[model samples]
Target: MKQFNTTLMAAMAMAIGLSGAPLAQATTPDNQLVIATSLAQVLSVDPQQGTEPKTQEILAGVYDRLVYSDDAANNTIKPQLAETWEIDNSGITFHLRQAAFASGNQVTARDVAFSLTRLLKLNQSASAYYKSAGYNAQNIDSLVKVIDEKTFRIELTDKVTAEDLLYRLAMGISSIVDSVEVERHVDHDDYGNAWLRTHVAGSGPYTLRRWVPNETVILETNNRFWGDAPAMKRVIMRHVPESQTARLMLERGDVDIANALTAPDVKSFVGNQAFRVEQVKIGGFYVLAMNAGRKPLDNPLVREAIAYGIDYEGITGTILGPYGRQRNVPVPEDWAGAIANPDWSFQPEKAKKLLAQAGYPDGFSLTLKTIAQPPRVDIATALQANLAQIGIRIEIKQGNGADIVSAHRARDFDLLLPQATAIMPNALGAMNDFVTNPDNRLAAKNAGNFVWRSAWDIPELNALRNQASSERDAGKRAELLTTLQEKFVAAKPAVLPMFESFFPIVLQKSLQGYHTNLWSLNRLEHVTKTK
Candidate 1:
């Protein structure tokens, strides 16, 4: 059905025929749910350090922030740890709910204060959100204070918008940790990262049962969870890298959910009575990232040529099908300040003219590297064919997701095809990494970020991105976003997104309450299996 890498497809074909493998028929308990996916890298479970999508999936279930919001709830502020919050002239003070950590430590204001202080002290992957708000090593401890056991306060150095602060605190990176639990595991300068990557310390619904690196991660429901108990007592996340194998496992009743099935793999199950397939449009965006500092791509006209050269509709219609949408803006089309379905058609003559304008009338050759998958390869082949007509000698290279992503980070490739998951639903969430480029040392903590690799230093765009948070006025903020997109499009800033795509989440018909947001976050607390 769905096309994958040729080699992987062959292996899957073999595995499908050998479905008699003991694992396929291993009786699944009704109380246990098995999930299959391709994990990129999960270095740490510490909310401040986990960076990959799989890491987010697990951490989202294993940790809880002070406040939470989702698309269905209109991204409005909702209480989680902090039951209520009040904003004042100086700053905002949050009233911590009477909750206890997995370790049975009553989550007091000291724990909250300690968690925020630790996050800033580590200055790991997600501290950029606070760093942007003017917290650093020196003053972060001084600014954040505690008032008694129930109240915690975050006093800011500079003025900030409530909208920005709310969403920042709502993010997974802001998940509150058990200060004492983390301290017990901290190693020499490691800050508990090595331990947290494989363990859990938050007050969320699930606790880590086991994590076998690239093989599997098992999560058992927290019996002492502050909220309602989870329906599935155990969530088994197995690393089945091949889509066809995952599909077969689902058909064989081995796993309850198959997260990374190929499109064709999903199509064959169209009318099946036992299984159901869902292609949810998450907050992930694909882009053809170029090193703006490099040659040829450095030319504005050349970058613009490549931008006009992509056949967004043709490839999306064929390879992507209903699984992806073609949109021009970074944010989802439904959100404000979003521009949808713009005319980025296949234009050979225009591309040639732009190339000539950039002093490359004969066109130039460059290597385009992407994940070695059928759909991705098909898209790259389409681009190669389309640009060839304009005298561009494009070389297509393929690798696993990790190899390609690592190469992009090193500036070792001419172009790379990658996807970015939206941290939040808004425009700021989509482009935060682009605007908040810090030193490589800071970025290494997160790893696999393209903004730092592009080596772009646009102060104007940075200021504009910062302005959206401070502006506060909804209409004026939208206007600022419109102008920002216009400038980014005009500049053709290294990243050229072909389309926004979705992935299929196949499961049994009886399972309910497994809705993922634009960012592909599914809270598994309420998922129930009637069958």
Candidate 2:
């Protein structure tokens, strides 16, 4: 193993033009934290435009939301820019802390108001939450108001509960920006969307130093930050997309942390004292989405047959291994309002019986679309094998993640294996994504809705989602959510959730205080490195 690592490091050095020079030191600089991760999905760093998880992780350090989840469980709320807040039926009022932007502008309620107004005006992917809550560009300015230099208020619509709105505000989409700094670069009435794509106007503990797309991202400490200063002076995230390459770089001490390692690579560091493997429950599920718009799949019995045919234990134990575990329900078990595990298990006989009832006694052939990446490809292969046992023939077709997702969004696939996560850390978020499909028409173009992508439209589930979203009482909300999940499982929806994902990350032993949460908001401000 040692010899293999050495050979790998040498090959990497030669490939990257470091063959003739001294290789990177075995120990990284004491004041810097280097990370190797895939930035393929990170198209923009703008808080209002960047929707990818990688982009959210990067912005977490450079920007501050009004509030933040206290921990991975997302059970409590903590203040960030807002020192305190008061929630009531009509709206929420926030008391802003006396802080300064990286650009030296005072952090004020007006900036918060403008940031939200700009978010709605841009109408990017980040605006989905606010739009769902009944806010739009025309009325957003009136909804978000500045009472004083330190006070901000956001009016609530009848469609959403205060708790629901608060959870949404804690997300990266609600990140407060420096209104003065951003407005200076507005172009063609774009509301600084064009400039923010490449630049950051936040007041968090880090400032964007340099960004070369798909190559490297550099962040330096923001000395003017009002909160506790970050221990690491600088952070450098290098794009290392391949798991093997990231493992080699991490083993050689060229990087301090590696994100998105395969199960095999993660196991390689299990007993090594020099490295630590950490897993965070990201509250997402790996699901098999059957396009109901396609014939045969449109029948509920056929969808149930597909679900029964899956070898949940086999896949979770082998293919997923340490990466994930079986979770049949749409809502993750750790989250609030989750129902007890259902009696869904692998029973080929039951699957065959259901198929025969659905008028496919001879079985049928279909195409399965999946992302060409770790675990996903392997999981798709496992699904193919399991379904074949029940007389279903699955032709596996693979593509890049983006292409596969584009096809799924277009409802152009018979079966799609994709990992779906809640936009917020709440059951409502999951229901909104996996169960609510207000309009099922192709002309609706509701690409963001996963249920719509699967072409599953159920008015009863939609009504339940609305009730749960607007329920103010915690007890009543929990009951409503429980009923929602029960009804979803009973309906045998087109989306069959297989496992809950536990995101695995590796770090050098010398690194400390590195934390991650459900939204991938890995704030590096608290991270420290020892040499």
Candidate 3:
């Protein structure tokens, strides 16, 4: 392994505003794993509060859920904190293994019960999963109960099936926290929400050592972890927002992994012997969401015209390259309910005719908001050109992912270009956000629901979504969802899905056993480094 100069390490530490002792060594140590990626959207590490991808990745290393979805495409899961579980018509019972937290406290059924109860009590974005299953703050105590010291039970509601419920339990929202440690820090009945944002209290392979906002996050191996010990003693995640900078650092061996590389940078290391480039298909889609409540977009004709005007083939082939593929359907193709090759094509003439029929021979102008990142920015520029061809003028607005997401949540944009990922592996995860909008009122502030954010309300489609979610038979549920998608496409809904994403990552050749699935649970316990 290459070693870095002491002066360089000191200088770099000072540049990122690190205080106290200077970095002793700058080299990639055998016992340490260094990753370079953008943490711009990571606001909190709390499992219940974090909704961004980066935050979820961090929490995956620091906490363990009762169950884990190892292969989301196949809809399969494996036990994590819970050694085994049994399911009946009423509810599911989990048999937890004998484990201890980093604080040396025993993991008990009470902790499991309390963790779920706390999630409902906090009423954060993550609570949406439980809420959909009919587990609310008022009903959580009875629904989630402790059977014994090592046994826990969660009653099922008529709103969801046991199979769908398992997928939800596998998500980060169901991560089990050390209740004793969290209760100790609770203040003013906040349920440790304030403290957990910056701290971690869980029984995973790694524990939070230090976090420096948008600069860095350091994690140390948990000595008391019940699972297999991690190969690296420490994992250092540095915030390198620029793709070129991350690429340069990876080339110089300053980091072992670079996750935020652009398509061009990723291709640069394609066949290099020193690096291995991986492209994994994840469950997400790049969408162009139109505000249905807005002026001209309120008409279905306008939304259909906008959808027809997009050059899906051009954008996916050029800008996306190896990063994504064109997918018109809202659901990911790998999921069970996904439609196979729905009827959609790029026709500028068709779009113009629709616009003319909508009483606008001369297309109106509107602003399109998008994240200021590679592919997305490039995609937006392509969309701008495509719409202009049909007489519709599109003004492009760019900002960081956090700012763009905030604007979408506030319902403050005409059109939005953003990637939407399913919270769970189940098809309901995507339908819940993209198709269902329980409340369309602006005062509801339901940022979790993408349909609500777009001000889209279709009772017929919403009714089908509800039926699909509650159907106990898998085959019947798939049929219902297919019908819902067919109707959704025919209605010209506000959200237009352009392409599905494929996450590309570059890692050192010496790194082994690193795996990430559709949900982006970057588990590191099984990973090792060869010096």
Compare the candidates by TM-score and give the number of the best one.
3
Candidate numbers, best lDDT first, in rank order: 2, 3, 1
- Candidate number achieving the greatest lDDT relative to the actual structure: 2
Q: Name the lDDT value of residue 158 in candidate 3.
A: 81
Clashes of each: 5, 0, 0
TM per prediction: 0.87, 0.89, 0.91
Q: Rate the local accuracy (lDDT) of all candidates.
A: 0.73, 0.83, 0.82
Candidate 3: the clashing residue pairs are none
What 10-residue stretch in candidate 1 is worst by lDDT?
A: 4-13
lDDT score of model 3?
0.82
Question: Any runs in candidate 3 off by more than 4 Å, and if so which?
Answer: 1-27, 72-75, 334-337
lDDT of 1 at 245: 91
Q: Which of the two, 1 or 2, has more lDDT?
A: 2
RMSD of 3: 6.3
Better of 2 and 3 by lDDT: 2
- Misplaced by over 4 Å in model 1 are 1-27, 156-159, 340-342, 371-378, 395-402, 434-450
